[model samples]
Target chain A: MSLCEKNIFKSIFDEWNQSIQRFIQARKIAAEDAADLTQECFVRLWKNCHKVSRDGASSYLFKLAQNISIDHFRKQQVRLKYTGQMASKSEKEDGQYLMEMQEFKERLEKAIDGMSEASRVVFVMHRMENYSYKEIANQLEIGIKAVEKRMHKALKYLSEQNILKKR
Target chain B: MSESEDILLSKWLQNKLSAEEKLMLEEQYDLESLALILERQKTLEIQTVSSDQLWDQLDSKLSHETKVDKNQSGSRRKLIWVALILLIGASLAFLLLAGSEKTIQSAKGEQVRHLMADGSIILIAPGSSITFNEKDWSNKREIQLEGQAFFDVEKGGSFVVESNQGVVKVLGTEFEIWESGKQMKVQCFEGSVSVGNLTGAEKILGVNDAIDLNNQRFSDVYNHGQLEATFKSGQMKYRAINVASLATELERFYNISVRLEKIDLNKSFTGILVLNDLEKAVEYLSKTMNWEYDLNEQNLIFSSN
Candidate 1:
């Protein structure tokens, strides 16, 4: 509302919008929703700008983004009920291969979804978002060793799913 | 694998493995499959939007909100002075009209759940509203619905749901009703329901039966498997449905518009679409149907590949 508040909000937005968006996207959220959620985080900050100091803005915004991601995760869990049986259709020339690939992809997705939140976040941040170990550590405020541990756990879990072995 | 091997695999994936470490890891475990998995994972990368563009959109939204806030505060100040003078009269009016019609509405991407006095539950879908006379509900069970809702009625008296398209009446049943513009769809998941259109054509739908009314004409009753409605389950399950209808479902579920270009609307599709993630849902649909799509903001364009 005030020029000072708007400036602070803009500075925070400029500093952290991409980070917040990437954080949510790394949590397996779609890009558009992640962008919307990132905007929501900033809007929330702007509304509470009177209470939040500029120095605390980073943590406040990231916390809001984390909470939003968690909420989205819970909602996705409720919505995702994988129960549809693939219909037996007349196969085209490459239908069998395509179906096999689709099945593997679904399995991998389910495997990732089944991982613990910590490990999944770390894994996706490194693998999908291309965040380096030290960068992930700095972003998550965890040690590099911790990031490596979670990434290892995620890889182990996926390997145990035998997703690649099945192929 | 041992802890060391697991760490090695993790490092290998991160490109943190040294030449000797990579050789040791490859000797113990196959690296080719890991490469394949990583390659597949690349295909799942999420598309990102430009931060500057999003900021522009948010800036406009914030300015509009600020304007609204200022107007609301100004109005509130004026209302406060007026309220002090009319306090007694307002209290009297409030008491006299305590139990009028109650309306429950859901905003975009929001679902509202309402519980009736009779222990029945109604789940209103996004961008929908329901109005009912709560005080008189015991005598006559009825509600007017605008968009879409899932009704889980307890067995007691006859329950009726009315819309501009038609009316649905049941003794006790679980059903979903969706009405918009000139189209309406009613699906009975539990007990039987009687449906009648504005043209006076009536039909009784049994469990798992569905009927569609377009322009006040009812389609022949069709039977589907026992599955929870989309509003209740957050998943859209289609069974050999046409592409046009699927597009409509996508629009309703995500609050987005889907446009078809040089494509056949009648091509049938059967699959389950999860409604939680719009990108994944669109990706699944396009991949399975062999269509290409472009999404911009809330508009999705699909074309034949």
Candidate 2:
């Protein structure tokens, strides 16, 4: 609640507002709707101003603008779809995500399980356990290039299987 | 694109591109190809988006709408490394330590709130990590800290946080510990905690107590009430901290690479940084110091004007 913090917030808002407005405009959101989205994003930033880092603010603002704009575009259809699909279910934030991942857990395992042995082991070490390529290569007594290749292979496998989409 | 270009694109997507390498990519590749690769890479991240309908409902109900035009959202990308955490977590469940010796980490721009088996809670900042033996939770309740964290401990026998240079012990208190590079910083908001180095040096800190490598202790360092929970609101407090130190902290939480030019490294500023926008934060820093900064693609470089 310090003036310094408030000043900091004001400065950040002034600096990024125009660009975010432009981004929202580019998305074809009406000026008023764009303004509303921009305002909502900034308001959310102010409310949760303490939880985020300084250098991450602008992108955060843009992300809010982008999502809000997207939702604005999809609102009518999305509302109908949601009410039709979810009217019977009690809304649970965590449950929604958990349920989304319900089938994904086994699918994720199957994707990994189907990888070539070398690629599978490398994938497990790098992706799951969070080991570095250097460490994984050193632990397995393979070259770093080999490790990268296997990881690339594993990723390619996942992409082919549609575990990780190729876009 | 050549194999090297493919690798370069991958590194660019991962944001592992060094300044020189990034410059090379921008110079050598067409925007179209880069966008194509980037568009493809974006699909690899399977992050969850917020429920617009639910949030709209909530927004309509409790409306203390801001007068000032403002917008903010959590950063869309994880940035440094791609992590489909739920997918990885579901697969890595067996890899977790069983009895004790557990390590908890937050990836860059990721905040992890971990509840210990005991009622104590550790909220780790991004690019920060912590490790503890869960078996000792009830007995001594010790944890080893690597970067920065806010600890809210239950009234237990004793809660301890061990850093590379020092250790903090408390019965029950709210405090923050940041161990950056070689320096250890401890700030206590409420109750009292005892902190000391491994060589047996120690001090007792009470409410509003602050200490860092530069200043051993200070009575009135911050102007905020209950400084420990301020981060929950989306702000970071830096007090008389040098530019290099501040830059390092920015890289940790903001997921940005910051480097100071030769002339700007020595300047120190005391300020609160609002993390509502990244570019604006850089602008604030540059404007405050009367310097110039350039954003070349992913890197934000600040230099003397």
Best by TM-score: 1
Backbone clashes in each candidate structure, one number apiece? 0, 22
Model 2: per-residue Cα lDDT over A28-135, one tens digit each: 344445556766787777776777677767666765664455424411110001112222335435676445444444455456556654565565555433568886
Q: Using DockQ, give the best candidate's number.
A: 1
TM accuracy, model 1: 0.44
Record all residue pairs in model 1 with backbone atoms less than 3 Å apart, i.e. clashing. Answer: none
Candidate 1 residues lying further than 4 Å off, grouped into runs, are A1-167, B1-99, B237-249, B257-273, B284-291, B303-305
Best by lDDT: 1
Report the TM-score measured on chain A for model 2: 0.41
Q: Write the per-residue lDDT of candidate 1 for residues B197-234, one digit (tens) a residue.
A: 98788999987799888789888999754345565444
Q: Model 2 chain B — which ten-residue stretch has the worst lDDT?
A: B40-49
Off by over 4 Å in 2: A1-167, B1-100, B215-224
Q: Model 2, residue A138: what's the lDDT?
A: 58
